[model samples]
Target: TQLLEQSPQFLSIQEGENLTVYCNSSSVFSSLQWYRQEPGEGPVLLVTVVTGGEVKKLKRLTFQFGDARKDSSLHITAAQPGDTGLYLCAWEGYNKLIFGAGTRLAVHP
Candidate 1:
């Protein structure tokens, strides 16, 4: 089974604090996608890193794909209350998606 494992099932931090979430797997994926979701809303794609050793940044958020394509990481700098949400990682371009357990972040002001 191609299962993605995420660390820190839940995190609570003060605003302006930085945090990192990780997604690891034994199986290699062609591409990895990161999404953030709020209550009652569908997940919004944060970033998609396809190439190994690729790094992409969106403002304060940075995403990295492992060279082996078996892991990914998301780092948020100076997190705010607006950044509090569920972060999910998934393998894309497959008929079925393999999603990580998810990391719930709560940033308090």
Candidate 2:
């Protein structure tokens, strides 16, 4: 089984503060994906970095994959209350997907 380690299992920040979440693994995957899940809703795919050292931006959020392809990070330029949610990092495993325990983020005004 692939094991992914996520940092800062819980995060609380004020609006407009910049924050980052990280995921690391000893195994390498073809791609690294980031998702955000809210109460009662399924996780939504925010972005995927397919190549090593790749970076993708979604509005104020930036996603980056490590050069070695075994880690990834999500950075928010300015956290917002709307951004409060469970952030998860995932990788393909067989025909399914394996996700980290996830980082619970709460951005308050």
Candidate 3:
């Protein structure tokens, strides 16, 4: 089982800017997932990357898994204020999910 660690515990940016966040682990994972959470709400799954070197795009957001399956990244283009929230990365481990320390993003309009 891998222990995930996310970078840039907090970020504040202006609208229309771009940013990237990362999640890394020493152990390999079968899959990795990204999620977004708003205050007072449960996290909402964004994307899941399974195969190594795979990339997935959702509107202005992009997700990628490292070739070794030990790291992942999330990129946002032209970020909007609505994008403000907590971003999390999780991987399946021992029949449960091991989540990284989340990144809190605040996009100012």
Best-fitting candidate, measured by lDDT? 3
- Model 1, runs deviating above 4 Å: none
lDDT of 2 by residue, 1-108 (tens): 339899889999999999999999998878988999997899999988899999999999999999999999999988989999999999976888889999999999
- CA lDDT for candidate 2: 0.92
True lDDT of residue 53, candidate 1: 97
Model 3 compared with the native: what TM-score? 0.96
Segments of candidate 2 deviating more than 4 angstroms:
none
- Per-prediction TM-score, please? 0.94, 0.96, 0.96
Compared with the true structure, model 1 gives a TM-score of 0.94
Worst 10 residues of 1 by lDDT: 91-100
lDDT of 3: 0.94
Task: Residues 1-109, candidate 1: write the lDDT tens digits.
Answer: 4388998899999999999999999988889999999978988988889999999999999999999998999999999999989999988754866678899999999
lDDT of 3 by residue, 29-107 (tens): 8899999999999999999999999999999999999999999999999999999999999987688877898999999
